[model samples]
Target: MTAAGGGAAGEVDEGPLDEIDRLDAAAYEAFMSEVYDALGGRGRDLPARELHGGLVEARGAVHRAALTAEDVATVLDGSLVEAIESVGRLQTQLGAVGFTLAREAAVRGLHRDVALSLTDWLRVRCPWLSTQEAAQITEVVKACDSPVTAQIGDAVRDGTVPLHRAALVARTMSRLEGSLDVDQREAYAEIATRAAGRRDLADKDLARVCHQLVEDLLHEAAPGERERAAQELRSVTTRRVGPGLTRVTIDAPDGVAATINGVLTSSLAAPAPVKDEQGQVLEPDTRSPAQRRFDALATTIQRGVGRPGAPPSTARATVLLMIPFDPAGGVPSGPATTAAGDYVAPRQAAEVACSADVTPVWLSADGAPLALGRDARYATPAQWKALAVRDGGCSFPGCSALPQWCDTHHLDHWARGGHTDVARMALLCGRHHTHVHQHDLTATVSGGTVTWHV
Candidate 1:
């Protein structure tokens, strides 16, 4: 019922402190030492149970005694460092065992998708490991199989990467799965792993640095696609947050975005004071910036609604796409390029092709307008409204931007041979649209659910 190493009660000797630290380190080391003997030493073919049970019992007794120690503070302070170091080592070993089981499960062939296989076990019994942690550890274990990342993976196993950095490297490796070629992916994974292990990048910079590396590597891997248009979609929307409040978000191209932001700033900024009848200046208006902006918006809406030739029911909107075509039949052959000059991936393009907000138009290969009537090139406003109701928001996986804040993206480029029909377009918000084309990401849309490859 007391710290095994704490000397008799109220004895303020440094000897007890030293003893606690020593015992804590020794306990964890002893457990790991036994594991190495079983797995790394001779006669490693069979599983060793009794040795592990004995080690666990020994560690448990020490832990219990330390927890009840009269000098509990001293015991806890010294033991915490050792406890963390011990868990890192233990995680590495257990994760490796799980990796082996997953790899060998099929008997005839090895499976590389090993990390997810252990999530169920961790979710139920491992109180300390979160779902994310379980997945991260497994990912690090999987990284060991890659030749490029093997060295870094070794660092994780040896506790060199520690806790946070190990998670960073593991998540980066998972993200790079579809974004890079085999060699490039492996090489950067190693660099990420090594940098993380060495503490070269701070926790805040780890993800950003990894992201830049991924972007650079993607560009390096597919330099050919750089010149092709990457889709550029922008939108704006509002959401009702409460009984009397709403949230508005806007995403637009750089120039237009600046103008919009400028308007908001001017509206919200402090106003100049008015002069009194005697030409003396009065006190400046001191309302909150938010209140001013709200008033300005309400005024603007009133004026806009009363403008001549500006009808609330009808608006002219334009979408320009630079699509490729089959020269022989004037048919579309490739994904459409938005006026923003971004390319759409084929699968995502197909998703749009099945939506209700696009209409097809026929054009000559010689750049002349064909005899196709207006109905062939235009979708009714109602069709677009229906499309919004169906999609609800951005169609890309994990995106939650509302439908009103999305642009109708054409699957096949209109410039090539695609029609403007409702069945050939889908909605994409500005950010997700940019990301999709930036990495040339692959996504499959089925019943409105998107499956992103990387």
Candidate 2:
């Protein structure tokens, strides 16, 4: 073991390494070939565990390796271990083909059974494939079985068997399995029964050809005829109801649209109209009959056009009335009851006015209404823009809704005493406006912060 001698310490041990590499390469090729052959078959039989064990042992000889019973079980139960091992070897020969060992293993594992069946069918139908060619053919088959490979499979099953025929065939078959209706299934069953007698075609090819024929026949049928046939073959069910206070019914295709009917007659022992402080009837104080009718028509139009929640477009019929000072003493300016017990505030008035579908009224204080009016000499458009910009959509908490979906809200009650100014005004959607008064929510403006006490 001296230096410069044949058996010296400096001498490298390359023989075993080279031999191991060669044997590993051969083992990988053999494994890949067997996998391809298995996929070509009907895949009814599982790959022998002993064969897998042997391959695993051979792989270990190439690189010191170990596998537990669980690992072996995993591989046997269609895990990517085998594909990983094989692809690793493939990478050595082909310089990293971008396909990862795990990915290749997982893909092959998932489609192993289908691939086996495909290989068997192809072998019977096209027996001229070389060993390497068949492996490549099986790979192509796996690729064509993807969801997007419909046209590829169509070409193959339709008798134009290309290089990657198995892939297209598998994809088409998978698609048919997903989309087949009752009639289609029956047709397929008939075709399958007829094709069972044809010995010339492979079983997979027979199934594929039958599917193709059925699809073509369906496609060639007249559109109306097909629709009628489909309708006849399908069953539909609907619910029925008896008449009630709230009657709802959906009409047939040839009849009227859906309808909801309700009675508007007064309830039993209806309360008499109350009188104001001056003995004037305190009936619902609302817009004129024409205004109400116009509003109803506008609302119907908006709803029909699917814009029910759209904000008011113009200030035409909209009005903001501010009392500035109480007509009578003792009541606060924000929200108070009048001597006649009527809520004379602009917010209340707006609610009553808008109920009849009049223009949206923004009731506020601090001279906000003066600034919001369209006439610049009285209240410039610039002032309105400034107010709109400052409010920044609806001021309702947790509701940063768009300006198109909002209406101006008056912070203080306008009837008792409140100015119509920006300081006392905030933007609120119609829904939030109703919620602030009708619901238990309270909205207040102080120090530029719009606080909503939910």
- Which one is best on lDDT? 1
What is candidate 2's TM-score against the reference? 0.24
Number of backbone-clashing residue pairs for each candidate, in the order shown: 24, 20
RMSD of each: 17.5, 27.6
lDDT of 1: 0.55
lDDT (Cα, tens digit) per residue for candidate 2, span 342-442: 45564454343322123222333452332122221121234444556876777765444566566555465443244456676676677667667554354
lDDT of 1 by residue, 207-268 (tens): 67776775575456444442221112244557579999888865464566676667667734
The whole-model lDDT of each prediction reads 0.55, 0.45
Point out the worst 10-residue segment of candidate 1 by lDDT: 107-116
